[model samples]
Target: IRILPHVHDTGAFFVALLEKVSPLPGEKIYKEKDAEEREAGESGSETQRVRQPPKKKQRTGFKEEPYFYFEKDEPIWPGISQFYDMNPEVDPTHFLSRTNDGKKRNLYFTNKLVKDVVTLNQDHIKIINTGVKVLVRSDNKGADCDFRLAQEGSQVLLPLFKKRKISITRDDMVTMLLNDDMCEPPEIEKMDTKTQEQCENLESGSLAFTHKREDGVEITLVGWKGAKSVRGYVAKHDRIHYLRLLNADTSKYEKNKYQEQRDLLQKNGSIDDNNENSNEILAENGTTKNDDLENGNITEVKENEIKNNENVDNEDNGNGNGDRNGNDHEMEINKQTG
Candidate 1:
């Protein structure tokens, strides 16, 4: 056994190597008693005693919806096969619907392996759903096709569609993606000459728009062509994703709250810095004025003290002069008396 240390936010635990050499002394007796009880219960030996009735078996789990694979001669296959110019090699049996009835809403596509698995184990297991949605029922009377192509399966079925598909340029793809209004899709005339020419004869329905780069990277998007306008059928998130792939600007869709907060802080910080700088400047000017006043007051006091000292010295000198005069007169009088 080994006990592991709790470090780096991990829990303390232990591991042990266990081995079972023998069973307990009462294990065999217990198993025999359990078997006897099961046998007695199965044999209905206690029918004399009153017991509750067994509950009826209840069905559980998800409801099973069987897949209905389409045949090559199915009535709905003709319209789709003719509209999309489906390749003859592509079998219609690969497509399926959830409904067995004639009213099929969506058609899904599956590869060989998935198809085999679903077909073989359909009766034994419950399959919730399988395959990619390739087509959906669009009951528009104006549309030539009954079903429209779905974006979910566009990549898988792109090569199988020869008609209702056009090659567009990077700019045209960007223009279609940027048009947010479904009612006012970008007009076909506004696109480049090649795209306009390619879409001239196309009917108002689903379309496959493909763009290839110089580096052999290709992108395929499902689109819808209206009477006079066309637009991409991609979702908002997918629109951003494809725009990123095409190296187009997607700033309109991307929002970063963190970056916005940082920008606001920087602007406020600049204002705060300006305020601090002005305060510092005012403080510096006030200090210089205070120093000048203090120096001026000290100089005035020193000048006043010097004037008082000079006056005192002049007074003393005059007193001494007077004393000398008096002494000389007294000496002359004494000499005359002698």
Candidate 2:
């Protein structure tokens, strides 16, 4: 039957084992060395080795041996005359094992397989077989006290203990760490005086007014409440008006009649004294004309009365003569007698 070998660097003796053996009846089965014997042998102590038990016959076609052991550097193979040392108490399942000498431990793979184990002493240790180069780190004091076993050309990760919570995913933290612009805050724009006035003039409790210039151009402004009155007429060249409301007493309408009369007289070129004298002369002329008319009427009345008295006397004489003529001849004799 063919035998296969598996070898690895463990900084100790390279050990190999074989299993699945067939043995004859009443023949002794192979046995490997126990830990006590191996320890005695390593120390060069001479002692009687224990003998193996003979194999017993079984109903099966062949009986299997438990295991057969061999050391690679040693020249023995399948030789059952002497027993090979084996560490029964040692846990083969572990990646590392301590030697029987108790001076050091051997890596199951290699010293480098265990990370972060620095070499503390050089003479106390040995490297048997390794897949890669082994680096021996030494301090200046020449007494190394630590051992670092790891894969060759591989990085070692040190154990780190953090005492505080770290922010790993916050956007702000990431931005700040990266020194990016994402952490900058937006800027606010400032308002100018004109803009502020316009805003104040807005219907939202803002004071504002419009002013007209001499060229008829208009401008609006905002001011404090009750600061100034905005009611006034603009002059021809003025751009603003400032009329205000106030309480003032009003007077009644009056006519200057005396002044009017004086003006009329002046226009006519006449004085008050000249006008009075002219009116008096006119009155005198009217009185003289009325007296003359009265005198003429009295003289006509006297002439008419004289004419009437003459007529009356003539009538009386005529009547007396008639009577005398009728009685003249008769009355002569009577008259002579009387």
Candidate 3:
């Protein structure tokens, strides 16, 4: 085996091919005993012993409930189909549930091929899961439909939906996506006039929000309407994906802790540089000479004291000259009298 180089940041893998070089002697394939021989062996009537084949054991995990596809007469299908104004081509039988009882909390949808596979091989194989969740049981009293459209299946059903869909503008889409708050979603009043009119008549339930761009790129999102506000039903990652398609900001949701830490360190480094420059300036200004850095008039007081000392020194020099002259004159008079 040779290791393959990583491509596009994918994990490295290895590839090898094996071929049979030599053939082994053919062995006779054994077959199971016939029903009569097995019955005779069990009844102890056979003179020759006929070995019976081992019985196949049922898989313990096969006890799981099989998918129960919805029928045309299914009660839940009518309300959902009518509320969304589903196209005639869309089949209600494709939807299924885990429970056969009247109560189904979630409805899943599978394509014809998957449905056939599940139905045909259910007894032979164990199917863990299949299909996308299309509807959830939300018994909202105010809403006409008891089920809400799931985000995972919205794209599959969007083309077939007619009534509950609203065409929104870029601003409207951005506004809805920006409001991440679930408790208080974006209000209808904050949306555009056209969007407001579209949502005004809508009942409080899941609906589709579509936006077409000038570049011919169309975006669709699963949204919910309420009595007071409207919100998108997208998961966090899916919300980021839709926001990217609309060219809206997704930085709020896509946070990088390492980038944040780098930014914080850079900010702190700048502050430290500023502090160092400030310290150097204070040192040059001789502020460290005195502890009272907060003193406002310290420099002015020092200058004033220096000037006063100069004036006192000049006064003392003049008085000493006058006294010397007075004493010399007195000595001169005494010498003349002697």
Candidate 4:
């Protein structure tokens, strides 16, 4: 029955009453209001009390809950160490949750999913969504090259991986982060020649590269290896941030030093050897000597090449005497040919 404010003509309220069914103690019978009794309105006096039905029972939803194991004493640390230097202090069970058995290949995690996962284990609790994905899988089925880290995970793991042994240089770091594409693994020596000898003995697994600039240390992760290339991945925003770290102040000093040394070794004979390079550099800067004469020389060269090509084509496009084009074009040949 709808309830109305008796005093004024204000907004009316809707009252929907759902009938509750309670099963008998012994028998498997639920006691519900008879349809015939509900149709016929209450004939009893107002003094006689009316029994209001209880609220409908909510769904438990426990069946749909996934099987989650959060025990800390698992042997997961050793397996993950093959890919990343696993920190035992930070509980991996809290964040890095696995799906099934056998290395739990389909691993998933996020920042604030801890509380959500806990609440999901409860009755009638639900989870809408989680945070960033961290998929670390392999291309094949078996254990050849299985420990591959994804690009998205690299952003968070780069700093942690920096402390580890596997790393690359500033120049190599820049090239690997050109895009999300897989590139040739950065040379170990170029990263830091005198850093350490242990850098050379790198394995085909998850690796991180760092470039320490004036601003900050830029890092990117590389994964997998096949066909003389590895799966190098980095975020675009991270790359742009690191690119600003390039030290541009000492450029003039380095260039002048290089030019001075090169000039000292130059001689009259050596000048001709490097003249083509000098001409290219000059041409790029819009410096052309004897421009008209150079243009005429290029035109003559082009005409001579074209005439030679036409004469060669005569055999290709000709039958015996008359040409295929049937045009009265004379063949250009050298007079000294005879």
Candidate 5:
């Protein structure tokens, strides 16, 4: 179905729904005869028989992942799993996937997300992409630690660490966000005694931070923490939220963190006192929205008052629109004089 908005003065839209018709078992194919032209049809070949091909066996249930034992990574799981209480229902081994690659592979917990999405690929339906990559090969070597966690994967494990012993202060959060890739976390000394000890024993990499925000919100930031500094990775969009959050409370973490946020906005030539009165709400539902600057479709929210304890109420940023980047940040930093 099609609708053209310009001509009809209605919104332009197109939509289609298809019905699935699989041939029944032992059913034969028959062509429809021309009823109008041929009235009293001749006997023999008037009804042509078109042979139907045999149906291939369809995959019934979900294809289960491999049966490799996660207990094998027992030594590895403790470092991460210790922070959060274990789920009694889920067996770690169930997360294992089939990997024929010679490199050692680690099992990541999809939290049953794969099985949840299996229906999308069933019944010959095409799946461009479905499951989130949850596990990383723990046995391999990263620059610092044996296991390198995927950015999303760390969040999957964040809950386990959120209330755990590795809470970092807000200042440390900014350090992790601003650090170069592969840099160490600055406040390793501020790490909780138990978690810090774990890091001391651990070699360079294997850096993960569970920032327990005031009022108990948890954000899991991952990076490599070496002897000196812990290097963490925050997606482009996340960086903006972090910056806005830090800036909203200048004195909460440190005066410098807020200053940095203000400076970043100014660096990008985004400042206007008049824009203060017309502030945009950045947060939505709970998270903040970051915009890509290159498309020039950036939406700005001016934090009129720096609330000492109030949260940064910015909308959630998305990259879905034609906005762009390779800048490694999700939202473009708009320099606001406020």
Candidate 6:
């Protein structure tokens, strides 16, 4: 049997139940038109009716009246964390790991996910029964935001971003991505200034390498903003590119020092046999020489020796052929004389 409840926006409620009970002889079935006419006749002001509209009842061999009522609890002011947990359908693609003082542990969905919760303003968001109350307020004056995760039994509230439109739960941001819609929220200047600064501080003019794979390709992007660091990203498919950028200032300093040493060596006079021997000694002890000639000389010498040996072998073969021809002519002369 169906039980229809009459719910008012305020703290009044009534329930109509379907049962096999018979009505008394003098009692008449309730009609919505009768109630409306009675309400019009009784009051002219709309302010007098705070209750919700009356629902029509079906005649199903049952006595129907106000069966039960209960008071309703006031809705709580939602925290940012409560917005994420209440909605089961929310997408968790970009999860963020937040740490405090390098030791405190806190994990939460990315700002992309939190923005959706704040946008939908679901009423059912509540704290979880077993997990830690994930909500923590930022201590920084600039970060005057409160965070909270939803508990299991909480009901969604009205949509925070809309005017007077109610939302029972947070909307999934992944659905927006799947639909090829941009899910990024409008940028708040004050809130995002620090992040923008960090992105800007990344050094420019670093090496970027592109790698191709069967499914998708990944590009390694490296830029030095300050200190050297490495990062990796999978742009497409499962392929990822690892990137490392040198510390710009430190690298420049090392280059200048090497240039100064080279200038000093050039000023001291051209590299002589003594200096070459010293360089070879240094190279043997792990230092590398900058001269290309020193590295290629051994291969060039071997090629020259091979070419000379081929020439000498050809000359010897030519002399042996001349002697054989001379011997054949001498025998012919002997035969002619005999």
Per-residue alpha-carbon lDDT of model 4 for 1-338, expressed as tens digits?
76775567676778887786865576443355556666876554334344566889887664442434445655654566545665545455544443445555534445446646654654545544443345455434322334445555566545443333344556555554442311123334444454234344444444455445555654455433322233344444444555546532233223464574444333223444565765543322222233222212111123345457667887687643575334434323333353
Write one digit per residue (lDDT tens) for candidate 6, span 265-317: 44334334356654433322221221222111111123345557667897887
Work out the TM-score per prediction: 0.60, 0.12, 0.59, 0.43, 0.43, 0.14
Residues 96-122 of candidate 5 have per-residue lDDT tens digits of: 444433444555464455644543444
Which rank order by lDDT, best down to worst? 1, 3, 5, 4, 6, 2
State which candidate, 4 or 5, has the greater TM-score.
4
Q: Which is the winner by TM-score between candidate 3 and candidate 6?
A: 3
Q: Give the alpha-carbon lDDT of every model.
A: 0.73, 0.28, 0.71, 0.45, 0.48, 0.29
Question: Weakest 10 consecutive residues, lDDT, candidate 1?
Answer: 292-301
lDDT value, candidate 4, whole model: 0.45
Number of the predicted model whose TM-score against the real structure is largest = 1
Local distance difference test, candidate 1: 0.73
Candidate 4 Cα RMSD (Å): 19.4
Per-residue lDDT of candidate 3, residues 1-338 (tens digit): 54876777577777878897756577333455668979777644435454566899867555677788888898877888899898989988899999988689778988899989988887788777889987777665557887777777887777777899899999888877776533346778978999989988877777788899899988877766876677765666776777888778889766686765455444443444465654543332222222122121122223345557667887888853777889999999999998
**Prediction 6 TM-score vs. true:** 0.14
Better model by lDDT: candidate 1 vs candidate 4: 1
Off by over 4 Å in 1: 1-64, 256-338
- Return the clash pairs for model 3, or none: none
Q: How many backbone clashes does candidate 2 have?
A: 18
Q: Flag regions of model 5 displaced more than 4 Å.
A: 1-89, 93-108, 111-128, 138-146, 161-165, 181-198, 201-204, 248-338
- CA shift of 21, model 4, Å: 30
Candidates' RMSD to native: 29.2, 69.7, 25.0, 19.4, 18.5, 31.4
Ranking by TM-score: 1, 3, 4, 5, 6, 2
